[model samples]
Target: MEKIFTLAELVEEYGTEVQKESFENNGNLNRRSFDSIIKRVEQDWESVKEEGRGSKRKIKCSGKLEDKAMKKDGRVRSGRQQVEHRIPMDVIVATHLEYDMTQQASMSLGKWAVEFGLITELEYDLLRSRHSSKLRQKHIDKAIQSGTLEEDQTKLLDEFTQHCLEIYGQLVKTLEHMEKCGIILFYENWMAYGKDGKVSINPEIMKKILKARRELMKKHEVVEFNLTAHRNAKKVKNFNREWKETLAEVKDENGNKLGIKYYWKEYAVILKASSKAVQRYLETYCVDSLEVYVNDKDLFINENVADYELKRKVNIMKKAEKRHKQKLQEYKEQKISFATAEDEEWIRFFYTQQELEDIVAGYDLGVKRLHLQNLYMERMGQLFELYNIKGYNNKKHLEGVS
Candidate 1:
């Protein structure tokens, strides 16, 4: 069985070297010394324990094991009790003293260096405030002024700023994309808890509230329609004149003319119509308008702007031949060059030279069949026959093979 040393036992066995060093070196135990002692204890725990006891067995162990050992002893013996960490007050004081000494050394070094012209006052200040929030900015400024910080550190700081800018740009782009995608980003907080100590607007409660609102609107519309129909029940001889001359006309239960004020109901209908018209207009035009704006601003570019731009260029090329009759030959040449450049750029960024050459060759082979709708099918047939391959097929049949 593997022996398991408790934290206390490990500390006691390893800590002696650190304790002796602390006393000799003005009472200080550093992280490095502590780590070294811990490593040595892990390597030879039993040896350290024997050294601590002057080669005598200090740890008492129970002789009784399981059934056989207990039968032999005729009585049960308890297992060995583990040691506990019991630090003397002197050790704590020594630790504090060491910390204070180090702090004093750092302060003295910083002050002396600044005063003696070894380092600038600003550089000294920055070193003093190395653990502060303004550390990076102060370090960057000092590095820029003195040109003393390492190249990697300067590059890292510059990269950090670039990363922040990229993040901000992405956020703006994502928001614009969401708008174009018909997603309304609402920011609202409702009464979460009521004075009655009841949970008010939880997610479920909000869902119910929305349901109620829709139900209420539906009922309200039906009631308003009934009222309007009842009010318009009586016909006037001169309809336009009667409507223009009407003052306070009374309304029945369904708001029919019992001859006194139906204007309130008429006003309600006008308001409802206006509201519906606005909603309808937004539903029809808002999403497209937002998408156009997003595209115009190149907002989507932050996420896949390069890909989108490449696609856009390809689309322009496809339309060019039809749109530019007078410059047909020029458009064709431009399209071919654009395609070649795009392929080269993509290959350079993503592939090895040999792979790029293979891809370019494949594209060249496919170019002959470009005008065909099933161009891949035609090219694959030719490629397969040229290589004398079998069992493989063209695009349409390859779908089933996969």
Candidate 2:
């Protein structure tokens, strides 16, 4: 099939020649003349191509240009880094606060040494004896100075400390940003248990807090969208329940079952969807909205029928998305470990998903221990949706279901 070049490409190739000719023949560039030109290209595609398909066509813009937004604020948002540290929670909250860090109890050296493999178990015991309880970063430094830890290990400790400082800085900046908005820490209830366990405030208190916050949320418009809009209907599979074999009704050889999937007659509508419907429906209108006039000899799918440049960009993005999903799947199945290449982008992406999923799942389990470690953070969970709606999330005026 011959390529139908866009107006921009033709203008670029023939320069003023095509534009002048098109202008003269069409009488000052009316829609009728432009349409005739496009129609002519459609009609004589083979003839034009057969004469000089020799030269490769470099496509140019086919439509209006877009403006890019740039931030005037000095705040720089860095890409996520693959570093974490065991900064004392108090120091993290109080770095800008006046304090002699040396006076504070250092983190346990035995734990740090064991986690980082900086020293042997016997070496850790010796160091712990010398420094007393709660081994600190200084203790690790002393160990390295005294020939207990290798020089490379000393470098690792320094990196850990630096990473901690960087994280603390980012945290402070984020808090500042939040404070600029209406969010604030107020009347926090905190408690703690053994390591690694986290839970919300007691259910009784949480119920009251959530009720109050939800009432506040009602003061604004509750933007809505099809939450499952991202799900591709074609790709959805039937749910496979383990108990189906036992509980499902018996089927005959013809595959007829005693039971079928059920649907309710009255579907409760949640959307303020009329405007959104128009916006989304417009996408599919031009696609197969009208029949193509073509000979029986040649027919093909027009899946990538947009502007050539746009089609190319879409293809590039699809390839990138495929690679990202492959990496994520590999990470999920334990094929890709983030330990060695923590800063690598795919590693950070995988770890972020893993960490967030873990935090969510962990929050779902056990009782509400009411262990609110960070005062500023406690009420943030309640404000999650509010942030997204109030433009703090940086996505505003969405046509896609909010």
Candidate-wise lDDT, in order: 0.31, 0.30
Candidate 1, 235-270: lDDT as tens digits: 322332343333223222354433322111000000
| lDDT by residue for model 2 (209-244), tens | 345434433433121111111112222111112112
TM-score of model 2 vs. true structure: 0.15
Candidate 1 worst ten-residue window by lDDT: 263-272
> Model 2, poorest ten-residue lDDT window?
262-271
lDDT of 2 at 212: 45
Query: In candidate 2, residue 205 scores what lDDT?
Result: 38
RMSD of each: 34.3, 29.6
How many angstroms is residue 19 displaced in model 1 relative to the true structure, after the best TM-score fit? 29
TM-score list, all predictions: 0.14, 0.15
lDDT score of model 2? 0.30
